[model samples]
Target chain A: MSTQLTTLLAVFLFPGGLFALVLGLSLKGLDRRVAARLQGRIGPPLAQPFFDLVKLGFKRTMVPATASQPVFLGAPLVGVVSMLVAVALVPVSGLYSPDPMLGNLIVLLYLLMVPAIVLMIAGSASTSPYGALGFSREMTLMLAYEAPIVLAVLAVALRTGMGQGGVITFSLTDIIAYQRSHGMFLLDPVMWPALAAFALFFPANLGIIPFDIPEAETEVLEGPLLEYSGPALGLFKVMSALKAVVVLSLGIALFMPLPFDGIWGLVGWLVQLAVLMEIGVTVVRLSMGRMRIDQAFGFFLKWPLLLAIASVVTVTIVA
Target chain B: MTDHTVACSYKIPVGPLHVALEEPMYFRVAVKGETIETVELNAGHVHRGVEYLATKRTLLQNMILTERICSLCSNSHPEALAMAAETIGAVEVPERAQYLRVIAGEVKRVASHLFNVGILAHLVGYEALFMHAMQVREVAQDLKEAVYGNRMDLGAHCLGGTRCDMDDEAITYMRSALDKLEPDVRELEKTYRTNGSILRRTRGIGILSHADAIACGVVGPVARASGIQYDVRTAAPYHVYDRLPVNVPVLDGCDVWSRAMIRLSEAVNSIEILRVCLDQLPEGPINDGGDPYIPPGQAIARTEAPRGELVYYLKTNDNPEPERLKWRVPSYPNWDALTFMLKEAKVADIAIIVNSIDPCISCTER
Candidate 1:
């Protein structure tokens, strides 16, 4: 009963529901502030995303008359829920490790895909033309990016599994513990290709510039999210913010899970998260323009896919 | 390829009120997946019947009314109207007023071109570059506010000559502003020329061929971009443009990038022209002491607006108001060419292609 209760608290309170929401929203707020400063404008306050959530909570959620009310309204809820669980699954080295019964990398990977699927379903269920375009673009982009990410994860799993004198390990705890003992994969030459591939995946998955074609604001009027307003729209924003934390923290855990233990590990992890957010997310998006849907699809197939395959082949040979 | 994936076609509305467009113009776009198969344009959302209203106002009053037709191309209307009035009246504008007239037109061209390019950056989702471009345009905006006391409508033209006189202080301010503006514009031009993000989105994206351009009668930078070496300031040589070193930059790329390059080159050229106008500004009255009487006759006049050739046809009779005032704005014919540009374009390129024409809907519909 206590184990179940602790797991519930972990999911809803500390690292997943409330904790991830605040941290994720804070990261998004920091992103906006940093982007504004880079663009030479006085951006909104650090608490802007929180204010937006509160403001959205007050506004009436308007559903398009033609929309599938159940699917359209329900999609964001699923995304938010998936992200909450995903966040709890991300282990902080020398700090909090998720209960093994909670799940592993495969579960997190499946959870990682939920937001894009939600967006696609939300788009098609809206019954608008732009939404349909959004649906197609989202599906295409996800298909293109998903393969490389899976291979990259496979490479990491094999790398950790092989190092442990086994075939493969899907457990992220084993991966983090292995890194803690064997030193960081971030410095390992064999792992560079996977790291590069994963870095490239950041913007595409986060839906920012360069790969933000599915929700290209100028093109399809933000595509799927066009019809959503009020708390419903706020839920989508919450999903995005939480997703950023899961993805970024996953990056840290996979490659360079910090050596420091206790509260210092928590502090170092967050500082690392902010640094990674600023460099990977902030600087990259500021300096790039969005790619066309076909161009983005082609780009993923050309660069990241090749890199992922290289990483996998290299790990296999080295092992 | 999978049998489960169905090849389907659908219609999407690009605007009546769309985010990409600054004006209310609708494009009924037919799409097979992501590619736009055909585009149907619906205009006149901004049809204010300004041509009819031009006849209701006196020539002097029409100067203000005509300038209000479109904000971006505001100065061109009154400048063209004043040219028509001068043609009918056979008034020789003073050299100083002529130089002043050119200065006003070129300033509007610089700000307008920067705005269009800024929007292009915006449409590509380069928000930083967009904000930077708009920030750069603020120089011209400040210059306008300083000199003409308004940002959009300069009210620069009068029947015989110019209404706005640049004193030594304004001239010095303009010269200093130009000195500051020239390098910033050059830097902007270079970024657009070399930036990978910009090139990937724009290059070979919107192909409006040279032959197609002529067939559509597209004018100004749109024509110049598609390799048609035409400019009203050069071809017709109105005002003091004949005297100024008007470098009409032409490109054969025939794409959105080329259109933007043409505008950038023109923007750089306009700054040089402004400098010359201020230097060679002859000593004379800005305009005739009062509004000169335009004789009862019909006259046609054209000037290069920021968009393209802006033509004004005016006819007067015994009444203080003109009998008729008609115009052919550059955006009018340019709208037809969108069918060709948007032919088989991706749904994403629709906004960028539409914006490349720099379509002034109010000017076109008015």
Candidate 2:
């Protein structure tokens, strides 16, 4: 409505949106590097993911004759939009709109599911056997990992506790501010284990190695992406990379405990966040082999799940 | 006579251009509601008429030809053919060459398992673990480079035995590499076995009954996973596998999970084999022969490739070039099991299960 509002929206929506897109895609590149290093080879550069996205974006799109057109076109866009929403929530700089709470932890959590749900619908819409197959995997993965992720987030929420300023807010900014003031990661005794829990669960969230069954290229070509191509495919590729960044940012926001409010601190924190995410992913990827689908479920169901529950209960008891 | 009846059958053409398995293959699945009635495999996707080309190249030139057969099992193809050449001419290989051949074969085995298991993990949605496994596997790739002098086409194998020998420094470097991979491999094995979601999807998904496995002529881990217990390494040990004892892990489940577990266990066994070979460090020349080209005759050589029993049949007339060369890759037999495996496998398991066999399409088609 106002020129000032328009300028502010441009900063967050344009640069912030582009930053999320670029950084998110950068995660994919980071993932490639980390994966390569872990596998004992020199992996691709940080720019490798961008190249892949451009390559996939420019490639011709093929759709099965029997598939529904809307679902095919809509799936990848949903992936991009949801990630964009997630990025908008991340406190990149001190600048904030009237309702910064829109990017809060709870909203981010709810939004995270949109891309995956969209993918499931797309997979179901496509008549291809691989699409249907990938759809089943995506559903199964959501069911298995969603609880652990929620539990991990809850653990972070517990560690930060509630501020004395007002009614307890689940806003990410509030959580970061609380940590920044009280030596962040230093609050909850269970923070280290919670961070570890995030480490184990994050790969599944990003669909990087060890948790990339839904789009197993060797087996299913590209999973939910079986039939997508051109711009639509690029969006999915970009969204995945973006999702990687969002997950890493969430990890940093809750765990890194750095003061990202200052300009220089924000840049330093972002770089550190990027490097940490890349190193975490790379070390894990190259060091291990894949788990079977059932085995992956088993892993989530076991120690990670238990730790999540334990962290929540511990926080509750301590409070 | 049994009537050839298309009774209540539907044709589901898979591949030559589709997902679930790489290297173009088409399976016309005739099914009666998930019960597969018959399977017709069309395998001409990657058939480059390599057998025809064998006549045009000299024995030495064919070495590179054999390597290109399968990008994954590049070393195994040429190694088997070279072994056949040695047998045809009754050539005596140097002791050092024998050790080197065993080293190369075992190292490739480790690397191939890493590659396959990584794919299996990737297919199942464990991207991080897949990358980790492959990253650790790079140690084997590095070792391949250090010992054989190349990563993919090691150029190590020859008619007599091998073209490469390890010096003390190189042997020490290789020993350290094995040492580095041991812990990582152990950690991966622990994670895969305990990881619940992985077990859920893979366990009992593709139950290849022992009877089905035998009838299908399944080789390598596919058969072994089904309780067939037929590892060419133990049954007919070649290239020093006879001297060393290897406990073949056989699980009766015969599903995708079992095959995957079998690969993991074999990877462990391969590391042990490499360690032992490196420690032994026998002394001799790299080769003990005249020209490696064999005299006129037909010879069949067999070796335990990463996938399974890879056999190479070579027919050499007096010409410097062989008349014909046929590489019987393990995937050929294993791919046939797909029709049976895919029957009622909830479509999602199709790709992951197919990848568990580590099908080398290039080698099979070549």
Best by DockQ: 1
Candidate achieving the largest lDDT: 1
Candidate 2 docking class:
incorrect
Candidate 1 lDDT, B1-366, residue by residue in tens: 658866588899988999999998999998999998878989878888998888899999999998989999999999999999899999989888999989999999999999999999999989889999999999999999999999988988888888889999999999999999999999999999999989998999889999999999999899999999989998999878888999999999999999999999999999999998988999989887887988899999999999999888999998999999999999988889999999999999999999999999988888
Candidate 1 chain A: minimum summed lDDT over ten consecutive residues — where? A1-10
lDDT of 2 by residue, A1-319 (tens): 8755654563346434676677666766766676666555687887987887778767887777898887778777777777776766665333332246344788889878877887788777777656665677777777788887888888777656544344345767667767767776645575666766777778787775677767667555666777777777788777776677677777877776565555676577668766877676765554444554655777788878887888777666655
Question: Model 1: per-residue lDDT, tens digit, A1-319?
Answer: 6878878888898778898899999998999999999999989999999999999999999999999999999999999999999999999888888898899999999999999999999999888999999999999999999999999999999999999999899988899999999999999999999999999888899999888988998999989998999999999999999999999999999899988999999899999999999999999888878999999999999999999999999999999
What root-mean-square deviation over C-alphas does model 1 reach? 2.2
Pick by TM-score: which candidate is best? 1
TM-score of chain B of each: 0.98, 0.92
Error of 1 at A73 (Å): 1.1
